[model samples]
Target: MHQGGKFIVVEGGDGSGKSTQARRLADRLRDAGHETVLTREPGGTASGAALRQVLLEGSLDARAEALLMAADRAQHVTEVIGPALARGAWVVSDRFVPSSLVDQGVGRALGVDAVEALSDFATAGISPDLVLVLDISDDVSKVRRASEDPDRFERESEEFHARVREAYRSLAAQRGWVVVDGNLEVDVVADKIWSVACERLEP
Candidate 1:
């Protein structure tokens, strides 16, 4: 089952329904008989999960939080993503570098170049062949999940989310990512994502 291929990443801001879409995509891939691995960043592997709590709730300094994210990403890529890809499994991550680009790069006011550099190193040179960036307005996102506890990052004001959205838009434009509208229903969004992914999966 070791057919080589590039990794795929799905990234978006809070309440964009990334988790729902990712699960749907993974399920579709499985039904289509493709080996697929569904996972999330900041909490994929054991090490990353532990770090996720600290990064989301703890009062670490901005620099420290950024560094911890990078560390967690490194471990995730090495332990989960790399091996899965090596085994011909299609890795669909709910988040990846875009979280850092938004949460740390723009939200925390860290420069884009610095975040990109750290992300490049942490991923050990594995760049996602296709990055699906879901775009949604801050207002829409805020209302999507009213019951979920607001984490430290999620507790930020609308101004912060606006900046993060801008950052994601900029990255999508710069990287030619597959930009999908997150305002749609989960199945519709997954359908669009699947189309893009299937196109890329072709020889």
Candidate 2:
């Protein structure tokens, strides 16, 4: 392990299993003699959770929603993530700025550059050491998402998801993220995520 805490981010479209993989990765890190903190975007703290509900409110405009997410991220980073990292504890986030870059930036036509700038401000200089992008087909994502209540983003059309996926791929290529196929079984997907996390965490 390194001197500072490792920040690992997992991102994907709805039903891509990001939450599941994040939890598993946290467990793996804990078992490997390291302290770990598991968190999620839009709801990592009390204020963030409150903002999350507003962000999910059906009446908010797309741009408004994006701004709310930014606000939540800023609070979460300052109150939760930064403190955890300062303690040299590994932080595994189920979703991070990448989600906004895809869903709000590309899918909502907000422009990726604008999204990136907002993310930078919201994150307050913290950057993930490694980002695991779980890529799955829209069909698969939709089928899996069907089991849950359709959020505003999930209710978007298939074309929207395609654009979001493309944005994720492009972002990964530009940012040196590790792209993983999310169509595999839960354990199989976790193993691949574990491998990449281990590679980055080992000194």
Each prediction's whole-model lDDT (CA)? 0.85, 0.88
Clash count of each predicted structure: 0, 0
Candidate 2 residue 40 C-alpha distance from true site, Å: 0.3
Off by over 4 Å in 1: 1-3
| RMSD (Cα, Å) of model 2 | 1.5
All candidates' TM-scores?
A: 0.94, 0.95
As a TM-score, model 2 comes out at: 0.95
Candidate 1 accuracy as TM-score = 0.94
What's model 1's lDDT at 140? 91
Error of 1 at 25 (Å): 0.7
lDDT of 1 by residue, 122-185 (tens): 9987767778989998779888645588888777788888898888998889888888999987
lDDT score at residue 134, model 2, on the 0-100 scale: 98
